[model samples]
Target chain A: MHGKRVGQWNGERTYLLCVHCHNPHSPRFKPIKPLPPPQRPSEMKR
Target chain B: MSQDPPCTGACSGETAPDPSRRTVVQFLAAGAAVASTGCSLESFFRKSFRELSPAQVRRYIAELEGRYGRKYGKTVTVGTAGPMEGVKFGYGLDLSRCVGCRRCVYACAEENNQSRKNPQIHWIRVLEMDKARGVDVNHSDIYYDAAEVPRPGHFYMPVQCQQCDDPPCVKTCPVGATWKEKDGIVAIDYDWCIGCRCCMAACPTEPGTSTGPSRTSPPPK
Candidate 1:
């Protein structure tokens, strides 16, 4: 609708599939352990 | 007292050029040329992807393949494929099926070869929000940690490049490093990026795009 295609239509293809990115069982993204923050300039050794 | 003073080189038309100064100038000029020869001036003067001709694109791809091959000690192929005619990409997600597991987050990072360490870069961000609020961004939490997904009444929403028809990121880019492609994909030319973070500021979705230190050499063993 309004130049935007909604719901998969015939003669159209998705660049990527949902299963390619999301698993059917657990579609939610898992929590990630963030990397350590960068060191402060004052904390650096000369 | 009435006699004229010695010329002392002041009354002379022009002073003799200093041989040492001339030699230094020549040496500097030669040194600069030599230094620049080692660096690829072709890359510095290379035009943007949209501006490059077919022949130039091929040459650029070859140069990239050679550079990456040398760096990785393996044959590397740099694809120069253009968008397909009459084909545009659209992405959709089913919120009802989403469980809030961040598998896509890691998948995207690995697929894009994002930097893993030092300055860790993730293009997609999954935010946890309360169901009652109904997509209130101010109340959403990106750092939510839970033992099991679909926690109580919380819902997950993953955000990334919207690939807007009129992208604000592209508009705010002072150097035109990022642009919207014909396939409805937003592309960033890393070489043209100046790390000014102007695009980041212009993006409505915070953390839509990420910037970090580029990995130049092979990671430490």
Candidate 2:
């Protein structure tokens, strides 16, 4: 069913199914710290 | 000629008669009652983006255009176009060639017209990971700021919306503001969204990736 594939690990991936990139449970991709924006052109090395 | 004494009927009090406090209270109560009723009616009749008819959409767009045009003193055209048919969107990145310059993040933010200040939003995030560990997100750092990018032994991975076949964000939206389009892209209806931040919390990607409208301040009058 679609619900099973909605990142909920109802069961292990079989011949019929492939695994997802993230764990079904607690699937929060947290970074070490908030990313800073791109550097300004003026800040680049000469 | 002798002037007739003026007679005050209700205003005969020693001190000049003042407006009744009860009258003011009643007026305030009536105003509050009407305001709440209007708000509840609006909430009850509010429709989702997908549910809006073409005519309704046009009216909404026109209203927004008028509001923004007045605010910015320019003609603003608020338009909504449906997704093109037969276009299933996807993205791929080659980690081998990435320089970790974060140029893509800037480009994406510009293209999406994301806010640059107060609650800044970016559509793309480039993560710097140690090559020794081999793609461990827990160990990955996106805040790395070295003198130069593509640092000796680190790899870069630019992350964005994955557009999963069954998006967890869609499943977690309490108000049905986000959903997976037929083309596999996850579309979010900002108008319909209540800014509950459920989708943001549910998204497996970066924490602040799927933000709704900011509720901290109201729009300019």
Candidate 3:
């Protein structure tokens, strides 16, 4: 559904997702991260 | 790190899964089904962003309903609004000029009216990150140790809730305990809180404190 909380605990990564710009829910119904930059194949195949 | 395992359904995979494929085939079938309905699914169980066409979104949502099934179809928690509403709090910290002082953390304790037996829980915290190559990743919570200010060479980053436009904690709250307000601040209904901790996990704020009651912490001077 919604992107899992922005910073989820990836035990392997050993870092927490800081809640700087995210709330668990929103009043305005905004997506946490802006919709991905319009996808470009050049960017995709780095 | 290598991403976690694929979610295996409406959470990922937009193309027809190859039945002939041997390696990721098992996950692909489930993914194809989800993609058919169209929803954002991460390559891993993560809940990553996926662009879904309208038909895909409708289908994905329906499938999610099916997967979670009857568990979510009915009310599992409290819905009655409490007097806790009409209350709001906001936190701001300017990282570009922070000095790694813990005074704000303590000040938050006194200002927010927190319990004194332990550390006063403030929604704000200052962290130190190494400016050296690849060292920002090793940042530490200075509050865990409560040290002196202006630790020589490290860069200071004081973090507080950005009061995000969208909040994941409120969405996943099974009890509807948390809600973002018109002011962009997210307030929790303490009376209705089920303490499921879903909100804490959903918050992206640093040291996203979970103690009962809350307050806005002052910034470092």
Evaluated at residue B188, the lDDT of candidate 3 is: 78
Candidate 1 lDDT, tens digit per residue, A1-46? 1223455564664445556655746855554443222233344332
**What is the CA-based DockQ of model 3?**
0.02
Candidate 1 clash figure, as a count = 8
B1-221, model 1: which lDDT tens digit per residue?
A: 12222333533686645656655665676567756777544553453124756666677788899999999999999887767787877666677656667777777767777755444556777778899999998998766766667677988888887777888999999988999888888889877888899988999887744565545323544
Question: Which segments of model 1 are wrong by more than 4 Å?
Answer: A1-46, B1-81, B215-221
Find the 10 residues in a row with the least total lDDT in model 1 chain B. B1-10
Better of 2 and 3 by DockQ: 2
TM-scores for chain A over all candidates: 0.43, 0.26, 0.17
Model 2 / residue A18 / CA error / Å: 34
DockQ of candidate 2 against the true complex: 0.02
Clashes of 2: 0
Lowest lDDT 10-mer window, candidate 3 chain B? Answer: B75-84
> How accurate locally is residue B215 in candidate 1, as Cα lDDT from 0 to 100?
55
Q: Score the docking of each candidate (DockQ).
A: 0.08, 0.02, 0.02
**Count of backbone clashes for each model?**
8, 0, 16
| DockQ winner, 1 or 2 | 1
Q: Each candidate's root-mean-square deviation in Å?
A: 14.1, 18.0, 22.5
